[model samples]
Target chain A: MVRHFMAALQKHKMCYALILPTFFLVFLFRYYPAFSGVYHSFFEWDGALLEEWVGFSNYIEAFQDAKLWRSFLVVIVFISANIVKMIPAIIVALLIFHLKSEKHQYLYRVLFVVPMIIPQIVYMLLWKFFYEPNIGLLNQLLIGLGIVEPDLPPMWLADPEWVIPSLIFMGFPWVGVVSVLIFLAGLQSIPNSVYEAADLDGCGILKRCVTIEVPLIMSQIRLSLVLMIIATLKGFERILIMCNEFGGPNGAANVPGLYMFRMAFMEGRVGYACALGMLLFGVILVLTLLNDKYVRVEK
Target chain B: MSAAPKWKNVQQELAKHAGILFVLFFAFFPLYIMLQASLKDNAQFGNNIWLPMAPYHWANWLTGWLAIKDFIANTVIVCVFGVLLTLAFSITTAYVFARYKFPGSNVLFYMLLAVMMMVNVASLVPLFTLLRDLGMLNSLISLILLSIANGQVMCVYVMKNFIEDIPKDLFDATSIDGATDLQVVRSVVIPMSGSIISTLAILRFIATWNDFVMPMLIMRDEQMYTLGVGLMSLNSGYDTQWGPLMAAYCIASIPLVIIFIFTMRLFVKGLSSGAVKG
Candidate 1:
């Protein structure tokens, strides 16, 4: 049995030997942190140091916090709004696939994905300008076109009701660009003959897309959806830049991630923020599970 | 010309121009606004919509630069080194996964995959404490190390996909000639995988360069700040030196810009590969 084991090891020595860097690195950083995060969640550690073991009290406090609940509500709204914005990317992907020429498909892709190449924070700055109320472009165009009366320009960021929607619009163009790029790639992978056969079968573009293109690209779409969800949930810089706080007006944009930032840095409630982090982690994990169910890698 | 051919030609010309026009408009619009805002005379900015200002030669970028040189340097050091170390670890790890199967390898690989699902936000507090306990606070190494470590999943994902695409027969032929795993990786694997590795490096570089939070949390001193944090400090108009601040922003973004311009093909390639799951 021992000789058999030695021979087996010799046969695959390289494989075992080759992966040590990744295993060691991941074990050091990711798994270690993940386990520690779970342990820390229960311990009631303030930012300064680990407090005496508090068990589920932190979790209970997390459940009871009214602000936390409000932040949770805001997260749901944020996620839904992001779903709305992601539609354009799906459409763009479909259109790119529909293009008769591969060259043209590449052309539009380069254009669409340009926004993503700029870092998220830089994009945030551009949107903040877009929402600038007194001298911003949107209202100027609205008044110029007689869409709104000259005397009444809508407040883009000032009023609490418009805050979340405005922020949502700012983030809309981003995912569409990146997702389109992903979906177009998936579209390309559907062997040409498959599409040619569909065409020979007398299926039109829209019909073929619904029946064929959608199924093949479903994995990519699901991935994009999950990504966009987590992105909106964990959004930080844009909110910080715009509101100059966790949320801009009346806690309207105050999702948990933003609230955690405020709790940690602004309010110095380190333990509460750690609890918020775990809650955010759980919520995201649930959504990710949903993502995995819908988007299988092997399919 | 026949009517069919004539019609086809006309439609093609129209579509071509229309796409270019749309692309140019969207691509250049925000940049135009950024440029205009950066250039407006003081009177033009505070009193009115900052537009139609003089076009200065990267003056805003210059303003950004002077305002945040030490900060930009700090960011550059952390990001450049962070990206390099990440590439070092990820490439070898990916190569191993692609080429060999060993005991518990599958388990380790999937754990890495599962880790990708845990967004960075979730682990920030624990990661902060870990850094503190390790006495990595306010250190440049802390940011670089964390950035490198954080990318364990992404790098593995990219590298694994690229390496898997290479056929096994090639590896066997090389192995029969007495090539070691390191030898094969150094010579055969790395050469064949040049395009993908280059692609991964570029993507990793951009990710680390733009990272805000890790550096924000880890680096203690003002001089240790990266571009993202440094830019934020400048954005407050603390120095109000708009020229240098803009300059610094331009400086910070230039490496990415140059890489984006040159290796756009690889960027698109990475996107497409990610689309093709497994």
Candidate 2:
């Protein structure tokens, strides 16, 4: 077997040669760092100097750390909120799909995509601006509506009670263009005969949607669910940007990812940061695997 | 048809329109606020927060432009070079994977696929240390190299499938005419995969452009900051100059908006296809 493989490699030398750059770069930049991260997690290093091997201590500390666990709890809230946020995109997609005129559907689709042209950082910052205590749109609107006095407007970001909710409410309407487009793609794939069959059976619009449209689009929804979960789990830049490095007031919005970032970059606890990262990575992997096993995608 | 039934149908259509328009209004409201605020001084913004005010502060745009121009230049250079190198490397590698039956090909392909599942944030610390050791910290070259390395996996995965679907006879014909592998790829692979290549390019461009974390971590000097980090600093100042800040946001978004305008059809098509396949 070894000899056969060697001969094949000799025959396909050019193929090997062509792929060398990709192999080199991926190994150097991706694989090497990943393995090094694992190695460094068992050490006592400051990232620049003072290196010492301490087996399992960092992991043990991570398990006992209440602040780290609190961050995980915060992320779970975000994940739940994100699941709710997926509904608006799905509903908008269905509405557009059922539109009688193809031209109108196309026009609405383009309009939905227009907002995505803005940079994501700009979007986050804009939301942060809205949450500002004075001269912010939300406070000003609340004051105008007589919900709150001008002097006593709720501090959206600075107030611990409002911080998490404000972060969740940053992008209002929540009709993500990618999710809408994905759902539309799924809807468009259903044969017209299916709809006609439903109609012939005297199915109402909502009944047809429940019976025909949704089951057929289960795979798309599952895909979006998994992607959203993973993205939410790994995302910290938004919190970092809107809530500052310490993760909002009294660390109300801190997630494990942001905590790791703070540890590694701010406090120079590089080894402990690696351990935190490993824990987060473990949660994501298990969640992804469980999702695959449980959310049986319909064809 | 009865007149009453026809009127009911019209009413249903009107309801649909209303629902869609209502959602669109909220989706666009923040952007509307940004535009209006861009035209207002702090005093005017304080007075009339909701509506457009008089004597538009056009100079705010000038201030915003001057502040972020260097960052924009840095980002453009990084993104352009990153996309081109990623494409060049991935195309050749994918072409090989598609055309050849080499030793351990399955193992190698699965290796590339496995990287997709490895959460990137987990490796941030080690990657930073790796770059520091390699003397690449605080450099645009580090950003470009890292972008190319990260971008290649998905491009190669997508492009390999695309290249394999090209007709076998075209490759055979090229080889019969004494074409080398390079020549065959140049003539056959690149031309046949224009739409997919462009799709991948646009996706990579957007990802690199919008990337905030890596740039924020890697770039130490203000001069080296990308547009995302630059915009953050622009908003982070103590005074909170609303007008100039909003103008800076608009300026930062112009490149992507322009790209989308030119490539809207391809972008939409690519997104739908990606959803279907991915």
Candidate 3:
């Protein structure tokens, strides 16, 4: 048995050699932090030393924290708004999919996707400029179009009421290139015979879409839905940049991710931040399970 | 009946074009504004913010480029090194998992896949301390190291899937010629997996180029900053500096825009594959 094991190990030595770098790095950087994050959450560590054992105090505080819960509400609204924006994306995809010529379809796709090449931070900053109260193009356009008086120009990122809406519309007409392309691919994968059969039944475009197209692309819809959820649940980069570190006015735009970031680096509350991180990890894991169990289970 | 349907088809086509045009405007308007702002002086930015004003301040690009040039070079170094490291680790790890029937392979592969789903924010505090202990804080290498480690899971998964599709006969043929496992991988697997590698490379390049969070945390010095970090400094609210800010934005986005124009096909394929397959 010992000789057999030695021969097996010697035969696969090259495979072991090949896997070493990734194994060492991932263990050092990824798995190590993941385990240590939980461990650190139990102590009042300042990144330099474990000051004391806090036990469950951090998690307890998180449970009772009104600010955290409020941020959670803001995050939920943000996520739902993104999901709602997917409708326009799907419609655009369907329209482009039904274009008369392949040439036009391809041209439109290139145009739509071109924006994605720009780093997303640039888009956030541009919107920040647009939200500028004094010289913003958005306010100028609104006044020019008589949507609002000059005196009543809405605050874009300042006032709490407008902050969330401004964040949602920052990427207005959010027909994401990836989502549209995925939807179009799903539409194309539907065999022509199914569409012809629907044509024989005197189905109009809208009716065919409602009954056949939507159902046929349910898988794709589910995929995008899950993606949007994961993205929004974890997303804070745009918010962090737009809100200028502190999650905008009065923490109105705070999500858990940014909240944790500020807690750790800004506030020196590393243990508390780890607790928040653990909570986020738990929520994401739960949602992922739910998505797998319910969202993708049907049909 | 034919005449009526033809008219209806014409109307439908017109409507489709209109809708597409509307979306195109929405997509391009911000970019148009960015370009216009990049060209104009701050004096013109106040009253004529909606459109480009007279006597374009083309010197803004020169000023902005000079300010952010070091950071841009730093970013290039980070991205190039990060992608190379990620590719090396992903290809080797994936090849082993795909071809070798080693003990515990299935468990290890699944563990790596699980890492992809974890909220990276959860690991931020510990990762910071980890780097600090390793004496890598506030350095470009810190960002590169984290990015490589962070990206390996997805890269491995993608490459492993591609490797698994290679015909077994090729591997067998290489082995029959007295090739070592490394030799077979080099001659057969690496050569054949060019398409997936390019797809992964471009994706990684775009991602690293746009990364903000890691750079923000890991690098403290102005010269050490990446484009995103540098852009944040330009907008640090001390001075709006709209002309220079917009100019810097344009300069920062140029490489990505050029890459997108050249490799739109591979990009589209990589993007859709990630979504549909996920």
The C-alpha TM-scores of every prediction are: 0.87, 0.97, 0.96
Top candidate when judged by TM-score against the true structure: 2
lDDT tens per residue, model 2, A145-167:
89988878899999999999999
**Alpha-carbon error at A190 in model 1, in Å?**
3.0
User: What class would a CAPRI assessor give candidate 2's docking?
Assistant: medium
> Per-residue lDDT for A86 in model 2?
93
Candidates in order, interface RMSD in Å: 3.2, 1.2, 1.5
**lDDT of model 3 at position B226:** 92
DockQ of each: 0.47, 0.75, 0.72
lDDT of 3 by residue, A6-114 (tens): 8887877777788888878888999999899999899887777656799999999999999899888989999889888999989998899899998898888778888
Q: Cα lDDT for residue A17, model 1? A: 63
Which stretches of candidate 3 lie above 4 Å from their native place? A1-3, A297-299, B273-278
* DockQ of model 2, rounded to 2 decimals: 0.75
Which pairs of residues clash in candidate 2, taking residues 3 or more apart in a chain or in different chains? none
Question: Model 1, stretches more than 4 Å misplaced?
Answer: A1-20, A139-155, A193-212, A294-298, B1-24, B46-52, B55-61, B238-248, B275-278
Better candidate number, 2 or 3, judged by DockQ: 2
- Per-residue error for A52 in candidate 1, Å, reads 2.0
After aligning candidate 3 to the native by TM-score, how far in Å is the CA of A79 from where it should be? 1.4
